[model samples]
Target: MEKEKAHESQNSKLTHENRFGLGSSEHVSIEHDPDDLWGDSRVIVNIGPTHPAMHGALRMVAKLNGETIESSYCQFGYTHRAKEKLGENRTYHQFVVYTDRLNYCSSLLNNVVYAMAVERLMGIEVPPRCTWIRMICCELARVIDHLICIGINAVDLGAFSYFLYGFHQREEAYTLIEKLCGARLTTSYTRIGGLMYDAPDGWEKEVKDWVVRTRKVIDEMDRLLTTNKIWCDRTQGVAIFTKEDCLSYSYSGPNARAAGIDIDLRRDQPCLFYRDVEFDVPIAKEGDVYARYRVRLEEIRQSLNIVAQCADKVKKGPIWSEDKRVKIPDKTLVHNTMEGMIHHFKFFMTGFDVPEGEAYTTFEAANGELGFYIVSKGAPRAHRMRIRGPSVYHYQGLDLMVRGEKIADLVAALGSINIIAGELDR
Candidate 1:
């Protein structure tokens, strides 16, 4: 009778725990030998604050049952440097330099967006030539950024040769950018009203040469991976998001276009020199990792076309606008005239006044839409500045892609998202 009572009591306790999800089979183990009750049932794995596949300092705590992932949660901020707080404290010009640290792959895009936002608040109009030049440089940045995304993704999928080829082409693009602006990675080349300096003499010829070489490299990359059976097997049907799902999440760029949504800020809501240029936005229907890869590859071709046209139309004129409020007088002029000297000193020290208002501007960055929201209180320092980085949006959508996917597919999904932790955490 006592044994029966004890058995009922233990069964009631088990039932009570299971009903509340506190002692389900996943969390509990029954042992014939009571001494063995302390053995581990749950498998805990740390996927990396330093893992090779993690891309950056992103970590994932994954719970596994044998080889299958039961649940996973991501951790970030290992690379955080409090960029927003720094922006709040710095002057507008100083903040432009910090923008480069957001997404190092496409730093120029960030610079352009931030500068444009401030310029809009100040009602500063950039010259037509300067606008075109900004477009050209940002497009070049798009190509460089996409090359890294596609190549690194391919590497994650075991296509090492494609990564090498992509990197080689990207190096050529970077060389052109460096030659034009004298900076490589973090190009703080775009100024508030225009570019930091004029494109070097013979820049058109260098850009033309790069355009031709890049086209050949794009063809080579296509030949290497586009129809390869192994490449398709690895990425073709992996990590798909429907168009509706993409829109619901506010996805943009190749990520949205991969799901068959036709929305390119360059074409739809034209800004800078995009309104004057003619180019097609490549899109794919599958929304898979392979589809995103294909879309970005085609975009490289379109970017080259834009660069070729810009090279032909690029005028030899002042890189900065004529507005005295925004542009400091040329150093040579400052030496020649008292008015130029005083204007130069005042512009450098006091800066220009921006009316109290807010503006949001977005550009077609390599990964997606890169936007800046700025608030001005008629001061040299912005009252508030916010960045709507594409990587942040992509990071938020990751769990949707990862859940119900195989453990290996998580790597593919991460690559498809193409998130830069610096942008995400910032």
Candidate 2:
């Protein structure tokens, strides 16, 4: 009780730096009770700044009445790195690495989205081959991201088998990523107007094999946990948010779909070759932990289907556009030809300038709608920049959804949303 009062006293001073949202996305000041005038049964607990249930780098300050939560406030500055400011300071090409940190589970998606924004700003359309590759990368990363979210959520609830099966398949996907980017986790594998390179020889065959193997693992997970009474009990009706609440809180991606709100950018606002592919946007009305799990599980299957289609249709073609502005010259040409040497030097020394304009590009990232809003005055770096990461809104909904829910349900809800602190704080 004393702890709760002390913390409330501290919060009373810092309310401006940390504001709490209502049940909706709109912010409203919450009264802090520095005195335990309510009751002595209530316990104040700090969930995490470094707890496993936090999925690393998230902290929540919650006031609990017995095991049920009363009020909750989440803090996210622990992993804050001034990423949006970095976008403004660094050249467009240099900012891609920073995006990798935003949602580390699907760095490839970040790379592609930021690339799309830069390409849009410069008025360059990537080749058919490049767009296809980007789509494949996005889906592959989706598979990996969804795998982590579902597997970890189950693991948090004491189901280890799913985590093992899902992680093994995730590693297989990483092998394909490594083959393409020469790195696994933080893959800076995109160029502004194209990819770092064309798919390595026979890479499509490797991805097809991985997808086949991953499907078996997904099926095994469904059999192992989907009907398990323990999982169902823990997740079925817990941490529910109604469709209206989902909209009010600006929920997107799987979180929104889990609440029976169908708004996938890939279908409604198609970009790249997303419209060319056919896949279902899985949704559920339960808006509970189980629904989020099911939505992600089904989405993984759809992503696998997309990956298969991309692999089959990935015909050989030019990977980079003819736009020399963003293209790094071929090394052989750089060493031998004066023209190539000059172009290479100019490209790196004076990075391609953008026209004096601004544009906002949105990509259906694994988490949700990832939008990059950029303003440029024809400089290599952006004059102003902003990132609309879905996690921020998702985190806002946390306190409302977890109200009166058990402490254990809190863990499940956090994992279900898959909040990446880097994205949340930025």
Error of 1 at 421 (Å): 1.8
TM-scores for all predictions: 0.87, 0.90
**Candidate no. 2 TM-score:** 0.90
Per-residue alpha-carbon lDDT of candidate 2 for residues 1-426, written as tens digits (9 for 90 to 100): 999977775564445434432334243344544343333447899978989899878899998876778899988878889987887788877787888988899999999999999889889988888888899999999989999999999999999988999999988888899999899999999988888878899998998988898898899899999999999999999999989999999999999999999899999999989888889999899999999999999999999999999888888899898886788899999999999999888777767788889999998898998999999999998998899999999999999999989888999999999998878887
lDDT of 2: 0.88
Candidate 1 residue 54 C-alpha distance from true site, Å: 1.3
Q: Poorest 10 consecutive residues of model 1 by lDDT?
A: 31-40
Model 1 residue runs over 4 Å out of place are 1-42, 334-345
- Pick the TM-score winner: 2
Per-prediction count of colliding residue pairs?
A: 0, 0
Residue 371 in candidate 1, Cα distance off native in Å: 1.0
Determine the C-alpha RMSD for candidate 1 after optimal superposition of all C-alphas.
Answer: 7.3
